[model samples]
Target: MLLRIFHVSAASLFWYTAWYDQNFINVPFPNKEYAQYALKGRVTFLTFWCLVLQTIYFTLSVLNDYIGTNADQSKHASLLRTIKDTLFVLAFPVALYVTSAFWGIYAVDKDLIFPDWLAKLVPSWVNHTMHTFILLFIALELVITYRRYPSRAVGYSIVILFNLMYTIWFHCIYYQTGVWVYPIYSVLNWPARVGLQLASTSTALGFYVLGEKLNDFVWTKVHNKMVKSN
Candidate 1:
């Protein structure tokens, strides 16, 4: 329960900071006053409500899984496979967005985004470099998935649709309120924005296919080693 609450809170906080304050591109340190403002505007209201729905969805899903009926070994295996497939599909674009945003923010000003408390404890470069590397590793992992799920046409289609919807919504809101959620998106002219969106979507889809392969390789190797030891 505590963990769930923490997750919900953290997710809400991040969304609020990103969507409401237009800090999505440059994640702010917790110490910044931008973190404390209450929600405002149509976009802000919509985002907050969507986050609430997401929290409910997560809660119900977890509860359902915890109390759901038992299954035979084969059924369990099939369910696990479905989950792996879904993750493999989703991980690609997620990794790309994460990495791209990391670089975008770092390029602007590395220290501004560091967590306030941690800022004093560690060097800014360390934080910046670590974040960059972690994002890159996630992208690499997404690439690795391709070896396992070589045919992810359905996944690619879903990702493209999702990105298109997101772009439309984001552009509409930005135009309506003259507020930009992400700095990278905000700076671009219409043509550039379109190009970036296309590039981002394509890269993400590619990464998703790659991620599935990497997951299979890692798990298979682990299983083989265990069997040999026994």
Candidate 2:
């Protein structure tokens, strides 16, 4: 219960900071470009989904407690368990990837990852809120909870769909404004653009598989301990 609340709170806080900075503190007034604010990019999309996933889990927890299920592993066909499994399976990799991509790019050239002008407005703490601590929060959740992963087909399908959607969205944005969302995309020629996109998609797909394997490993140990206790 406490951990659920903490997860919900942390996700909520990240949303607050993201919106407050964009809608309130941004210079020259609030950002009016809806595409710029759209949940198309990784950071915003993942953060948004984290809040959603946490909220759903929190509500499910409350519902279970109210109905006196109390975390029973065998109840209502494990509906809550299934939902949480899918949620974490999808969310874990994305959150980890977001943090890794940010720092990885930041290390190479901060400008490529984050445009300097917007980057200057954001403090290190805020940057970590979206990147670093988000990963930590998900990690803590993983350490405490055992998630039963769905099949690899389901997991890989979702990842592919998500990456495709975002790629299309960026293309649409470019079509609409004759400018790419990230400056890096604008400089790339057709072949280079395709190559970069493929590399990124492959990286995300790798993370999806990694998350599944990690979940299986963790929960296998947890289940073993539970069996031994019995």
Candidate 3:
């Protein structure tokens, strides 16, 4: 109960702040006030969506625990947890991978990607909010609660559909604005773009599998410990 409430509050606060900064304060593009990036940004946007998903997830969980009937609670809880896990599995890798990729590119040619000018506009805390802390929050959720994953067919299908939709979104943004939202995308050839997106999709799927395995491992260990104690 406490965990769910905390999760909801924390996620909501962080995302609201981020949305404000991204839309109002940061304004990455100069002379383009009111030209909010919206859907055409980095993986951070995806992370934001995951945060929104979790806020609802935990909110529902709280209701399920306190307000829902027992039998109904289990059904609702299981479905909500599976959805939360799927969102995390997708958000975690993308956040880490994007952050790592940015640093790598920054180290070599900072101007190419996260140039110093832009970095100043996007402060460290904001960066961590969108990138680093996202993974941490998701990890905390997993540790505090273990939920059984749905079958791979259902889980992977939902995840893959999201990735595919995002891919289409980025392409549409490029067509509309003639600007690649991420600098790294600009450097890639068509084949490379295809390859990278495919790799990202595969990596996200791999993380989902990892989450399932981790859930099983941790819960099994916990069950054994409980049994031994008894």
Candidate 4:
């Protein structure tokens, strides 16, 4: 809807601005002029991804009856799932905001004027690791839900469709503006970028399958143990 459009537009903007200003425009893709959109580009990129993730989760929930299931289950399991889900949902957007804000601050004050302790704590490595973990968690959750309702081919279809659309949208934007929201896309040429996108998407699907298997395995084991104790 309206939110989705805004998110995609914002993420696209942020992504282009970050790349054009940081690296792309002056050197290889010099002909590609995007400075006009650079200021809002980073914000756009972040917002788009946030919306994408939220849409994915919401769609999945509706498809899986999560939104309409029995109230009893909610009373029993809602708290734990809510905490994890909220964190999972918030993690990426927060990271993007922090990164954008930091870059903005740095742009204004060329020198490292922030408190030494705070500056030291926010290492690039840590940020990278955290982002990776959050993305993995998202992939895992998707996989788990997929496993929970494997019989529903429609659910899988929706997931596949969404992922494909996202990939296409990402590549198209990168090509048009010469900016990549994720480093993997930016570092690779077109062929490589396409290959990486396909591989990453497949890997995420694989992780989802693995998560489903693990959940099944664990539940079976726990059930057997309980029966034995009884």
Candidate 5:
């Protein structure tokens, strides 16, 4: 019951944040250059996309908890479980990667990932909500739930497919706007850009592995407690 309440509350929070971020319109930049990217169609951003993903994951999770399972793990549960598992496999690693990559770059050079002018416009809370709180929320989900991770081949394939699709999407955005989705890409040459892409994909894959290991370790402790109680 407590976990169910947490899922409902988290779903509401992510939904609110994602909606506010999408509809937010405050022109912090003086000129059209930054305004075009900052206040306009934001789906081009991986961070925003991840926020949307988290929103959907939590919403689905609430539904799954309420009606997805019974004493027998019924057919309804099986279907919802598959969908939840697929979304979790994608959402967990990608969310972690985006948060890690965002803060890592911000720590070294805010301009590269988030510029000063942009920062002035977006609220500090919104900034942390999107980048920082996401990590905490997802990590909490992992600690509270035991998800059966897909096999390495299946998981890696899904991760690679997502990265590849986003790679194409951002490149298309660049072709259209004459600007990279991230400023870091603007400064890198082709070889360096390729290397960065590979490194990022690898980092996300590592997070997937870490999540699986953590899940197993956490549930093992939970199982022990139940056995001891019995």
Candidate 6:
């Protein structure tokens, strides 16, 4: 019951945020040029993409839980479970990376990652919903669920592929539009950007390993407790 509620609420919140962001009309910015960029390019951001991924994950989770309640042994239920697990391979680490990286950079220099104009344009709750609540929800899910971690090779491959695809995507966007999706990119030279990309990807890989280890540690303790009790 708690799981169902959590999944439902999460799905609803993410959907709402996505819709809000897509349709948002910025208040007058002192810099009309940046306002135009923000309006057009906000959706292209990795944070928005990550939010979409998380929304899909929770929606699937809700469906999976519902089906399990109705027909726990059904083939459809099994398939949903499989899809959920596979999607989590991409979702968890990426969400964690976004939250951590955003704040880490934001702390050092808000202008780089999230500028003052962005703060005035986007409501605090919405910003936190995107960056802060996401981590909290995912962390709660991790505590409640016992996912079988994929082998290191398979898991790392998924994370690497996703990171690489996004790297290519932003570069392509910049090449075409002559605009960096995030403010930080504007300050980076090619070599610095390359270093940043490599570091970001490496950090994501580390988070994947962290998730696997944390999952194992949590469930192993649970298993041991059950064994002792029995």
lDDT of each: 0.48, 0.65, 0.62, 0.44, 0.78, 0.78
* lDDT: worst 10-residue window of model 6: 68-77
Cα deviation of 20 in candidate 3 (Å)? 3.1
Candidate 3 lDDT over residue span 1-230, tens digit each? 57657666666667575566646554354224215454424333454565455455555545545554223122345554455545555554555555555566768987986567777777777666655665666666666665556688987887788788878876776776777656568899999999999998887788777767776676786656545766
Where is model 4 more than 4 Å wrong at Cα? Answer: 1-147, 152-155, 183-187, 221-230
Instruction: Return model 4's CA RMSD, one decimal.
Output: 12.1
Off by over 4 Å in 3: 22-24, 30-113, 221-230
TM-score versus the correct structure, for each prediction = 0.49, 0.77, 0.74, 0.41, 0.85, 0.84
Evaluation by TM-score, superior candidate among 3 and 6 = 6
Q: What TM-score does candidate 2 reach?
A: 0.77
The most accurate candidate by lDDT is 6
Question: Whole-model lDDT for model 6 versus the true structure?
Answer: 0.78
Q: Write the per-residue lDDT of candidate 1 for residues 37-63, one digit (tens) a residue.
A: 344232332233333333333333234
Best prediction by TM-score = 5
lDDT for each residue of candidate 5 in 95-160, tens digit (9 for 90 to 100): 899888889988998787678888887878778878987778788988877666678899999999
Model 5 has an lDDT value of: 0.78
The residue-level lDDT of candidate 2 at 107 comes to 95
Clashing residue pairs in candidate 5 are none
Estimate the overall C-alpha local distance difference test score of candidate 1: 0.48
